[model samples]
Target: MEHSMFCYQCEQAMGGKGCTKYGVCGKSPEISNLQDLIIYQLKGIACYAKPLLEKGEHIDKEIVKFVENALFTTLTNVNFDLDFHLEMLKESQQVKETLRNKAPHGNYPEAATYNLSATKEEMIRDAVIAGVMYEVDLDPDIRSLRSTVLYGLKGISAYGHQARYIGHHSDQVDQFYFIALEAINNNNLTLEELIQMAMRAGDMSVEVMSVLDEANTTRYENPSPQKVNVNIKKGPFIIVSGHDLRDLELLLQQTEGKGINIYTHGEMLPAHGYPGLRKYKHLIGNFGSAWQNQQQEFDGIPGCILMTTNCLMKPRDTYKDRLYVTNVVGWDGIKKIELKEDNTKDFTEIIDKAIELGGFEKNEKEKEILVGFGHHETLSHADTIIKAVKDGKIRHFFVIGGCDGAKPGRNYFTEFAEKVPDDCVILTLACGKYRFNKLEFGTVAGLPRLLDIGQCNDAYSAVRIATALADAFETDVNSLPLTIVLSWYEQKAVADLLALLSLGIKGMYLGPTLPAFISPNVLQYLVDTFDIKPISTADDDLRNSLQQAN
Candidate 1:
């Protein structure tokens, strides 16, 4: 086989088709194939584990955790470490063997019985056959549904992994995961069955997101609306980025009074609103914009950088030495902070690096961004919101938030938010808000027009807010004056989209581009059934949405 690859698991897939030579996210062919092998090995493990789980047998905690993190590791821009991908593959096979040993004898498929004793070279070569293009005989629509469920499962794994760190567990979500993983290998399932499976995955994603929400609020009090400073303080400081709140908490505990300040970047901006985390005074504020601008914003920064989850770009040479990763996030030639024997990650290395770099010289800007308008906060204003609608003080509610990236045309989100009428309130979340978050949207119904509802996983909070509004108005969510315009990039957004559709909500304008994996038939199914749409201009979508609401 020629040394090549194909990956289309993201919104910016090359030409919106697939990446054949290398990933546009900076993943090399070697890393890509190794990730494929891990997925194949995981399928083998699931083949065995699902059956064992069915019989109510014991599966080790580590095995379950591995399955989740390995899926997360394969997400675009999350892990590009060649060695780490190989290591994950090795462990996945060990997990497969362990589960296989405990299984009752039965005729299992090749995925369940494949040998990993082949040389590394052979394993990489095998990935071409095992990767996304597998089951060449499968119907294109069926393939799209399968990819939908599979990719949504990746999102579930990401949230599930983070929730566990805060000591939350959900057997139902885990069971669904095992079933979905095993089912994806079955090519005989029809499109209807796959659609049902996809819906179930969406429902399961809700449960998983709920688990994470509970875990976060349980560990750190539910967020309240507060302003997060974006300017840097003069001192030895570290910029912690990505989506892992628990990791941020642990780092906060370790760095107390160490003469080092901590500033959040990207999705971590919401951390400053959590009561438990915000209590730390040295945990200063956010440092920059969304994940996509890191290469430029992070270039040659004096402070050390710690990435806890996804949204990693290929590092520029100037900042590589100052960068460190924790959890499942990985990149080649970068340092990592690993767990000790007691399962606690000592962030001493990054802390020391921040000290050595001498941190920021002074405050760069006086700007502060608002965050923490979670379900708890938004619901607190429920009576006011309902009254505003009744008095005709509020018109429509526009939900324009999701994952953000460096793709062209993402400016649509920024443009749409700007054009939202003053009578309507806007709800936003995730890193996507960086597009217009800095712009003042003023007030609606005595509340901030732009409500920063929290992180990507906090879509559950947005759902809660919407559902509560519908209940107050004596209608369902679809009947409420809500228009969802989303900007999606990767798998977390995939799960969020599924979760919304599972609730029977419709008319979500999605852009800057549609998923490459969704076949024409599957896309039509969504359009016909859910009234889903690809976004046009902000002016057109806004006009259409308002007209529909009337």
Candidate 2:
């Protein structure tokens, strides 16, 4: 084969192997090669950043920006333009050089030496020369585990970057990324070592999530239970997707009373709950379900889609012109609102486009979706929840949520949720809730049995609830009668896993396919430390989960 012309990095990769001849999602080989180079460069920068922390050097805002942009660029369905990747590489190298100059004698950790600054062609040629071709080259299980960690880190990087943008930074998270990246690149490390490293990554993720929680609540005020509309009113409108609230806030301000209505899409659904954002009458309702369903959901949808972050699929030609990208998300011919030096985005063009497109024919029927079950909102009902538990009305709590995917096994989530005992409460967030959100699980002591706790980033809500329950019962989080049955499809899930591990929340059931990235040794480490298990049949997994909780 004269060098495959396409590549695959998602769960639905063509033929169960990466697409090298043409991306199933339409990405060209040139783009794949560039993305690889970008990842390599990020690893290189991470390697460099690691030693700085050990040497007691502070990480400036620029370094954080570089790391965040690099990781965000590599997320599935984000940036697909080679030129964009080249620019990012140039920027990454510039940042690396600046950091090196500042810390000439600073510890240059081995992990930082992955040489990600090479041009795309150079990096691809080097890969060919090195003979490390694709995930198949490594041990299958190891490849899966490594990919899991990589994607998980990508998710963490996205959330971490957003938090930092809002003035929330975690030294431990930065350090953990450096250490984990270094460990992943280490050829001499044993499977046991890698597995332990994965768990450590999870532990570090806890601090990162906490930092984000503090940043979000302090900046936007904690989320409250709020019902959002799905009706599209007549006039121009903009649909904002992904999970960055800061970007959403900026767009909300820019489009304020501009006669352009705003709608939240995918993970952006939870934006309706924050006091700072909910006040906007123009913000409107959620457009669709998880990121994977956009092709069908967005088809023929009126108005423009303002992409603030990842989970962006390849756009169709019809709606392609209406899609706008900000931050690191980009595609050929797509209009992207660039962020200014102070991390501000100019959405003037997007607002104008919405006006040009106008919107749906008229004010559609109201589709009220339940959201805002974050820590603050959930805790507000603490007295009621505690009373339910004390009175034996709510006997069990099941956190059944994670990133959504196209896999057939995903239906198991709905099945499991339906099968959960009547006395059980299901706390969900992210895209996974679409599996069962439409089902009315009724109430346990006046609280809905199925709680929609914001988006995937809002997994922090589940953690907070777990900790509070533990505190109220005077026990450790692990000892509480709660079970976390998670399904992951991306990098953010990896970060969330790390957070759970860090907090010592054990006995988690993770499934819908074990990450193809985790090596057996690493998997074993998780099994031993966190007792993490993959989901089997819905009935079997549900039974096991309930038994563990009991």
Candidate 3:
């Protein structure tokens, strides 16, 4: 009789409503229940950790990691194993209990006092009461805002997970994780107060993303212009996917001179530009295309497939045996490449598998793609870019970026990028660039027409570029001749969108579909307040954005 696994946190929910029985992403009722319980336990950890943070006391590092992982695990299509979530949930509860007991004695919330269930049946019963859906407010508008804030936090937590991996941590960002979670539990707040809370979460996203950017650049060097080969070379190789550069680095270092080549896939394609990473000669060109096409492209692939983070789909039977995952990515039966406590991973078995498979035979018609146009590279030619703007040669800048999905309307991104006038420049990041990254967009005043900003974590770099450009022109970011047309298919996009809204950047376009979690009143509020529009036809959107810039 209880809610049968209700979830509306993403764009691909069933019928544009809650997925009440099973997730459209292939998550079952059991997995959804475990994910909900994981959140319930995370709230308790926040209850204890938040106050210690406020009083300038150190909350244990392990607790922070648990919270970050718990939230990130619930991201769409990231994990499908119920047992993994249960084990993590059990560990999360232990951490929560230890923190509650060790804290300087003060009143604890109900979340802190609650005990995790010992069995699957009891856990499901408890989740019906503890899940986010249980917080149904009398005011539909307030409920809508709270749901938005929770989704935003999920995205922030994901970014933080990646940041912490690269040794970047921010006290402010850590503190807000608890503050935002606690805010979602407070039901008495007025509608206006909830709106303010959503904006505050947005502000936190900027700080979180900045930490990730620093972590990546400091360890991997600033990205610069580099040519990436799109054609697969002959011989045994490994196709590295997802956004973890460190994982890629380890594989590249381990596979050197072993007669096995490593190729980037999806978000890893941008790694070729980092001087430190590109130095490895064996780290060859990218394989296949976007994430959505993997089921087909990876079918009977002759190399090993390793996914380092989110955006992993259900691997097809043809290649599932050869595929591997690590760093918080897990599927039901696929093998996970394990890392030691010291952060070292053993990819030797994977290497052996690649050799056994014996990759594709040589193709004489090798193709090349260009990438590595991060902030440093883009701004290296700042004078020329600025002068082009002043000379009216470059009329507009369109920031078209976000995750790629198999949704019907995603073609809008490809068409939109293709049709942008020669006088305009396109800045892109994440897998969304795959929609058109292969296309040749020649130079304008000695600058490439399209710039590949690093992975999704490099959204921080995009903001930095915009801020610097605004400063150069002596105008605010919103006042600059820039338009944001985003394609979002996951939680990270939600966090990035909030970061933009927090900056008061207005009139952005979002698609292939609006989040199912944003209720009617909340959608109306976003429209009235920020002028956020659901995308229309590619031609209409291009014309409108250009006209606005003019």
lDDT of each: 0.88, 0.76, 0.85
RMSD of 2: 3.0
Q: Which 10-residue window of candidate 3 scores lowest in summed lDDT?
A: 129-138
Off-target runs (Cα >4 Å) in candidate 3 are 1-3, 104-109, 136-138
Best by TM-score: 1
For residues 312-376, could you state the per-residue lDDT of candidate 3 as single tens digits?
88889999989999978899999998879898799998999999998888854778878898888
Q: How do the residues 80-175 of candidate 2 rate in per-residue lDDT, one tens digit apiece?
A: 876787788778777767666665464454435445535556656644322225434676655555565676677778888889889888877776
- Collision count of model 1: 0
Per-candidate TM vs. native? 0.98, 0.90, 0.96
TM-score of 2: 0.90
| Arranged by lDDT, best first | 1, 3, 2
Question: Worst ten-residue run, lDDT, model 1?
Answer: 117-126
Query: Sorted on TM-score, highest at the top, how do the candidates line up?
Result: 1, 3, 2
